[model samples]
Target: MGLSLRTSRFRGAVYFGSKNLLPRNLETMKTRKFLGISLSLIIINLAAIMERADENLLPAVYKEVSEAFSAGPSDLGYLTFVRNFVQGLASPVAGILAINYDRPTVLAIGTLCWALSTAAVGASKYFLQVAFWRAVNGFGLAIVIPALQSFIADSYKDGVRGAGFGFLNLVGTVGGIGGGAIATVMAGNDFWGVPGWRCAFIMMATLSCLIGFLVFQFVVDPRRISTDHDTGKISNREKLIDKSNTSSVTVWSESLAAMKSVMKVQTFQFIVLQGLVGSIPWTAIVFFTFWFELIGFDHNGAATLVSLFAAGCALGSFLGGVIADRLSQIYPHSGRIMCAQFSSFMGIPFSLFLLRVIPQNVSSYYIFAVTLFIMGLTISWCATATNGPMFAEVVPANHRTMIYAFDRAFEVSFSSFAAPVVGILSEKIYGYDPKSVDPLLGSTREAFALSRGLLAMMVVPFGLCSLFYTPLYWTFKQDRENARTASIKETEML
Candidate 1:
């Protein structure tokens, strides 16, 4: 009897031990999946935040440079010209690198470049030096963004891609907020009597480099790490063979052909045109923060308002993705079209109200803040929501990165030119006062007012864009139906 009891006890102990170990194994798996998702999100957010930090840093830096060197309105245009021209020029190269190299290495190099460029900006003495460094900064960002976005799209499945992108946008929004908040806080205090604005750049550069190091060390390339069957590993030789067989052309030739193909697609052409039109307001608002301060608010106040704009953009991005995803399940193309149309249509009236109707005396600051938040939400949603998905779907998976890069190149080039033109307009139309002793010393307030007023005029382009979307949607619908029919016919033949 004693032997029987001892044996039974041992058996019970083994059973319980195995049962407990099962949960531990499951928990470990869960933790790993969570970490993987979290890491990807962080990478996406970091890329966006790094680019947007330039926007947040602009106001403070502009203030410092203006005070130090007495930067005029035209000088500000030169700064924009440098930053945007570099970004536009580097986009195609970045796209090529993203497709050819390992994404992690490319991103690491980009992060390092960005960090060094930002640091150089802080250390520079002359205006031309600042412009040159800013161009380098833009070049770094040009590499980072396309690669990061392509990685995310490659990692996610279509069913949940929108939600994943929405989450990524949320993370990016948080990063932007964090960047602005940090700048605001630093600008509020003098660290060891170091200038607050200068400290902002130093801190940003340090953080960027540290994050890059972490990414280089720990962030596994999703192409290598993802276990999804769709993302099968292929040797470089296989990739090259596949490319050769698909187009019988060199990479650049293939890229150019793809561009021609996309342009021939009416939907794609319209979308690109609409994107350019919509982008003007976005670039204007981001760069005009310095003018905001010149108009009325203190540095901190302007920063806070910009932070709110970022928040609104985040919300819009999330909603836009969700709505588009759901609508695609039902109406196919209608949701995205409506989202763009409504946002642009509504933006016009709101902008006009802010510019023309609002009385200037009673805390116009809050009014502008509220208007900007709405404008940001609508504009960002319209900008990113449909275009990303359209680009992803219209182009073949292999060519998506190149097509996106090409689209970016066109949009950025035009906007780069447009930014300087806007600045010039401000100087000519609003800033110059013939009666004033210092005609060259443009009135910042009038400049901002003119900028806002000019932005409101974009309503015309927005309406034109909305009209263009109709034909684009019809063309996309036809193409989709044709593809579906062809797929069905092929399966039937099989």
Candidate 2:
């Protein structure tokens, strides 16, 4: 009787233990799934906000500054330069900050800075003050972009990194589209006695601040994801085994070191040069509102057209990412260079045709719009596709932010120098008289002609930039082969 009772108790104990373990197992799985989804959502949201902010601030501010200060194309171009110049100076510093500090905290600070700077722009009574705040806003953006990109690269696996980047680009594009339309509507009509442009800035600032709060509260530091295994309580042998096998810290460090080592790679140097050249044309488009007005569009029309441009960019980014990812399977490192080359080639012809051959008839508006849309699609998508994958391949996941920041710094610094030079060249070489009117055709037509001519010159640099990428492709191929050989050797040894 005693033995039977003991056996029954043992069976009961086993049943209860299994039941308790089931819930705990389920809970662990649930937590992991939740974390994955949460991180993805956060990344998407952050991308959207960043893109939205960019689109919102530039178009509206250009219009407001031009109208208020009676500024010409050169003055407007200088303003664009100021924004990018500050970004150039700030990005590397931001990258260093990202390396040493908690990413979420750094990002939150950036977001707040963006909000306050934008708000200050809206409130500014002087042109210099507006320009100052715009620079401040650019500084904030410089901090945010690299940090967020690094987070995404660290969070996602290599196999799906392309898709992950694509999604991020897509979200950003969507946000940009929304932002453009919002800016257009707000600036097109006065809201509650506030100037339409002021309202736009206010709205952006409020949204930025709100998003910053969300990020600060809910975004977990990726560093925390591996801390449990990094605890000092583990034996040295066990730690060594883990380091050789499943340790995230070791992987992270290796990835970072690989990126830092890129300075030694000649291919990376060429890529950075290419990036700088590409940035020149990109900056022109960002300040395109000023160009548009010079080309005969009013503020409202320019805003609408900019919105269309943003839409094209959104579509292009998504398509480019998908195409680049597919091509990468076969060509590996060379795929991005090919995409960039094709795009650059297409841009030269398209831009030259638009500037040189297109007639100034009323119907030209429709034709130009279509052309701009196609240009927007191809340029934005192709640039993004090339940049995203190339950067990912060249740098380690952890060091991506630092490399990207430095890349942006170089790109922006050169581009900023180009902007003012472009402006001055237009004024001097193209015979642009901001005060003069062509009695027969009108001042607007004369301005448009000058702007078109200046934009045409930009195509030269962009086309020439393709040459830089060719050598980079070969270098990347060699690096990839070396890595593959090493990886195979390790597998065999194991």
Each candidate's clash count? 0, 1
Per-model TM-score on C-alpha atoms: 0.81, 0.83
Q: Model 1, range 269-309, lDDT digits (tens) per residue?
A: 77778767666655555454555555555656767777777
lDDT of 2 by residue, 335-431 (tens): 7678777776677776776667776444467777787778767776544566655665655434567777777788887888666666677677777
Best by lDDT: 2
Q: Candidate 1 clashing pairs?
A: none
Each prediction's whole-model lDDT (CA): 0.65, 0.67
Model 2 segments more than 4 A misplaced: 1-27, 30-40, 43-47, 226-262, 298-300, 436-442, 480-494
Q: List the residue pairs that clash in candidate 2.
A: 316-381
**Candidate 1 wrongly placed segments (more than 4 Å):** 1-38, 225-265, 432-458, 478-494
- Top candidate on TM-score is 2
